[model samples]
Target: NGVMNLSIKDIQGEMLIVSQFTLQAKTAKGNRPSYIKAAKPDISVPLYEAFCKSMETHLEKEVKTGVFGADMQVALINDGPVTIWMDSKEKDY
Candidate 1:
């Protein structure tokens, strides 16, 4: 079997951690997405923070993050196959 087993430690690039609370959205009832199942920020914030901290520990470096609970706009230019490298030296907007 030509299966490639990879780990986060093997990634030689920066990690961007975004908190997507919409993952818990329930759309079974109606067209509008209901976030009733989502954890409130009071609970989710700590979990999100913990996850980013854990990832930083695993990668042995500080991970980049977006503003929590803010309406943010992200633009991505995915050039190659699954990997997009951004120069970390650039200051975060």
Candidate 2:
């Protein structure tokens, strides 16, 4: 049961997808983080919508999402403590 054999479509649970651009912040130069690597709103907005739509299509259900380009407060109680960070640019992450 611990095997990685499930996805959002296979799991019976609620899915909440939020657009977080700050995840691309670069802090190499100074104390203040730079968001230069993050995609611009013009490009990211449509991509975010398309991504959400794709998720809905795959899961066969409506997926909940936060408003784009809006200040949001998110609070979550993570039932599972496991965390995995993935980067597309780097291999074997």
* TM-score top scorer: 2
Q: What digit string (tens of lDDT, one per residue) describes model 2 on residues 2-84?
A: 55677657677677889998888999998999999899999999999999999888888899999997899988887578678
Which ten-residue region of model 1 has the weakest summed lDDT?
A: 77-86
lDDT of 1 by residue, 52-90 (tens): 999998899999998889888876654234654556476
Q: What CA RMSD would you report for each candidate?
A: 10.9, 2.0
* Model 2 worst lDDT run, 10 consecutive residues: 2-11
Backbone steric clashes in candidate 1, count: 0
Q: Indicate the residue-level lDDT of 38 in model 2.
A: 94
lDDT, model 1, position 24: 75
**What residue pairs are clashing in model 2?**
none
